[model samples]
Target: MMKRFKTAAALMTAGAMVLSMAACGSSSKPAETAQTTEAAASSAAETGKAEATEAKKEDGAKFKIGVLQLVQHPALDKANEGFVKALDDAGLSYEIDQQNASGDQSACQTIASGLVANQNDLILAIATPAAQAVAGQTSDIPILVTAVTDPEDAGLVEDNKKPGTNVSGTSDLTPVKEQIDLLRRVLPEAKTVGVMYSSAESNSVLQAALAKEACEANGLTYLDVTVSNSNEISDVVNSLVGKVDAIYCPTDNMIAAGMATVSMVANENRIPVICGEEGMVDAGGLATYGIDYYQLGYMTGKQAVEILRDGKNVSEMPIGYLDQEKCALKVNEETAKSLGLDPAAVK
Candidate 1:
């Protein structure tokens, strides 16, 4: 995809260069042909000059973009990459200042302030915390948020369909009921599941509630385990070792970052960990029927281009969502093996 974008940009540039060179070559033609070539050369030169001017105008309109990410986890990182790739592919001229809060609220506030001070043309917030921080700093700046569970629940937007504000983007809200069902299919004998996430993250709290409802509907009992930060991850997961048959982890930033720790303890106890997204499965989870963060980010990036290049109103832009077809089964075969489960069977 990147190669395609670069090639398209190169072709646009090459067209102007070729036309200019043609006009110059025509100028050096013989006197006999000069009479004929003169008219042609003059026309060619004018067209070439016009095209060059237009190209220069496009190149000169460089947008200033700021990216505020909540942490350094793979899911958020992939979303960030996808967003940037969209800008590059669109051939939009822009400069970006990317900042990560490293899962700290104070750091998020500080970074948000700097971005607002810099007065960026657009801001891409990778998670709920980053979105809230940036949104609090300015209501005028066009903000695009990705990897968030429920934009309405997070208080980032007035409504998901019509943001009615300067904030709008993609949601990483995976199919919670389907995921819970996946856990049941993977562990037929499992009766109790541990729903784990960081209590401080509102998105996680929302997902935890959904997981609980899903569990009840699926005729399974659930145990709620909350941690405030990464340091408490291992201990919390360890506490669930013998208490639950399996674990359901949400797309929480802190828990995503500490997935390895969670998997280490859970797998050691022969407990399967079903995650909310592919990155968590890759990190160490047994499986997940979840959305792709890269695609979600790319979806958001397309929205960025619509606002920055097309001059579309940010407030009226509806929240973007990946279709159910975009969700796929992702499994860590090694983790599945360790838990004495067949990866093929889960799929």
Candidate 2:
């Protein structure tokens, strides 16, 4: 195999020397021609060996990856974990720098700037805001996002099918209609639902709109309550207590961070909360037909591998989505019993 890559110059020179020796007379200086051909082959072999060693070193170089997480909630945390695990599982050499914004937009900006300045080979943004923050910094570096509902809606990309920029990854868009149906299955008589989320989250707003359309299609009245921050979650849940039969919370980072408060308030009123993801359900919401964040992140990590390892262009990479088969019903049995509903019956 290595001989095949021998230099054209050496091969041509060796051929020319043999032809010259044959023309001069078969027995004239045969040993000299043979020595000349052998020297050319040895030179070519050395060149090939050097080139192969250089390529091997380049292939073994460690990649620098930066992680910019929007917040430290379970969904985002799982997503972060999944992304790292994928790289490890692929047996790729990498040096990852993980940074959390602590749910602060300002912090997101700061961290994103630092990640870009560090000149990482790739950057993984865990949510919409973090994606936006990192994308705002550079157009050349590949960025993979997870736990984001709609990349185009968030202005991180021009199209979902073709990102047309240095941004692309898996979408955490859960089944809104199915989640609403889950609520209906659990509370057949429920006529109204309070759709709650953080006003600052673009992903939440997109899901909220889908939830509204689903609610109308199901013949249920929908009320929307928006909070600017996590501190207002308890108050917002309180405001929905008398106004709606149930509360529907999307996979909003802010809202998920305060799920315990939302649960404490909504469960007290015997109003079940249908969430957009499993983590929220575990945090005390009643149920959800939601996508797995870890799986979503793992999917995103695969995209990163394609970009970093396989040299796939991020701009041409279509946005990835988790199929419905990966989504399932998650119900908190304790919360169900507390709400006077059978845990198994809700299913």
Candidate 3:
């Protein structure tokens, strides 16, 4: 069945969104949803009903958007919430088909293709993997991404200016050097930092390189550890426990989802874990010099409205950045105390 938002249509407005959604859990829905919806939509589009459905949008119907999130985690979830709140505040009535890939690459492919099959006006892909999956399925559909660290490095665009395709959105590339500086200030005696992330995510790889550079500049040894998926997080983190002074994780989706696992193992060994975003800090990270994901998502939501309502070309939209990066130190008081750091003074 087709999911439609039936309401009076008005131009989507660009507004500041304050509501941040709760962290998400992976969707247990079958991966066939995309295939099933695609087949159904193909049949409808063939029978002229699809055009009729689109005509409804011209007659006071809601705008439809399909959101494909890579996994259930705080950063991604906050971004999703901000996007929805942006739409609501713009007074543009809309319906969103939100799907989570459960940190599975194949699941991302299935969800992205399905959203394309359903023929949503625009597709919102959170995370690099989600964006890549949808971009692979169609270059014609406008895809707006958020929580992605580096779009150009991930091969999502030609460059920030003039994406050269039907894709563009916000980049959550916080300053790695500042995050490392935060670690040095807090753990002044630490000599080696362990950097962990998903091996498969290009964004994580990019951030990890910057992290290594930051560590070098601080005269700290960099220990690298990576995993292909969440199943390896605890064991991998455990292996690196005594060998490093601290752990640094970028905005890697896999690590973000299993951060509690990373935190549990690392904290048990009394090592401080520094993260790339506030959501990670909230999860179990000792601290982070990170960005507010809610604001990032709101920015992506504004891009969505611009493409759908203002008739702007997404390919030329110029990859968006926080006009002023909202990066700052956020510490988990409990985690800090566990590591013997003065939580209040650290802040």
Candidate 4:
């Protein structure tokens, strides 16, 4: 597979060297010849290619995307994968410069500032904080956010229906009410549900509020437990161990990353956790009405194409949401059984 690349690279280098030699040895054969013209043509073609390549190097493609991700976690990673996959499917040429904030808001600010300075053709911000950081920096550059629960609440857009700014993209707003109801169906006799999320993420805070409301609407008591970061996750989970009959985790990045600990504590207490997304369910939450992050990102990528290729204004583009079909009912049989609930009945 790499053989052609090596051959082509060698030919390009050779053409450049021959062009240089011809210039130095021009006096020896001052008159133009067919052979000299051919060499000159080949050299000129190579030079043009070199210039094009340099432009590609500087911008990646005529279309460049600077991606700012809030953290290195499974759900966000999948969203980024889907965003790239959509761009690939569209057959559009693009360059992606991805930066991970490693769960640090300060890192997100620095990365967002650099991306704005680079003057990329577009910006892909994953998660709420990442989107907020980029939106805070520049108003001129087009920014598209993925995996955000509420873009308007995060202040990334003026309206969910119409952005009215250079910010728009997919929202991974999982069905909180449906998830809470599913928890009820799984554990009917259950009384209290602990809602866990990161206090720092506006998305999580918003989702937690929605989840709490849903719990109240569905005749279930809700307990709110929040952590500022992963370091506080285990202790938080432990504190909720015997206090709640079940746990309902929101579409939160920090909670999603530390779900293993949450699950460990939940399982030990025989509490089934109903998560906001599928990755959390897979991470050991009993079940969820979850959205596929990849599909969310893929849809966002298509939106990006409209802006880059069709000159659509981000300000006019409405924020996108995953269809209900994109969100599915997923239950972990093993977790269900361990909690003494019949898997089918849990469904």
Q: What is the C-alpha RMSD of each candidate to the true structure, in Å?
A: 21.4, 15.8, 20.2, 18.6
- By how many angstroms RMSD does model 1 differ from the true structure? 21.4
Candidate lDDT (C-alpha), each: 0.89, 0.88, 0.85, 0.87
Per-residue alpha-carbon lDDT of model 2 for 205-323, expressed as tens digits? 99999999999999999988899988888888888877899999999999998899999999999999999888888899999998878888888888888877776789999999989
Candidate 2 deviant stretches above 4 angstroms: 1-59
Q: Pull out the clashing pairs in model 2.
A: none
Model 1 weakest lDDT span, ten residues long: 48-57
Model 2 TM-score is 0.83
Which of the numbered candidates is closest to the native, going by highest lDDT?
1
lDDT tens digits, residue span 1-347, model 1: 99999999999999999999998888777766878888898789657634543564477767889999999988899999999999899988889998989889999999999999997878999999999999999987789999888888889889999998899999888899899999988888999999998888888999999999999998999999999878999889888877899999989889999999988888888989999988899988999998878888999999999987776788899889899776899989999888787778988
TM-score of 3: 0.83
Candidate 4: tens digits of C-alpha lDDT, residues 1-347: 69999999999999999999988798556555767988899889657644554565456566778999998778899999999998899877887899999988999999999999997878999999999999999987889999998899888888999989889998888888888888887788889988888888888888899999989998989888889878888888888877899889988998888888889888888988999888888888899888888888899999988877666778899988878765788888998888888888877
Per-residue lDDT, model 2, residue 38, is: 100
Q: Candidate 2 lDDT (Cα, whole model)? A: 0.88
What total of clashing residue pairs does each candidate reach?
0, 0, 1, 0
Of the two candidates 2 and 4, the one with more favorable lDDT, higher being better, is 2
RMSD of 2: 15.8
Measured on C-alpha atoms, candidate 1 has an lDDT of: 0.89
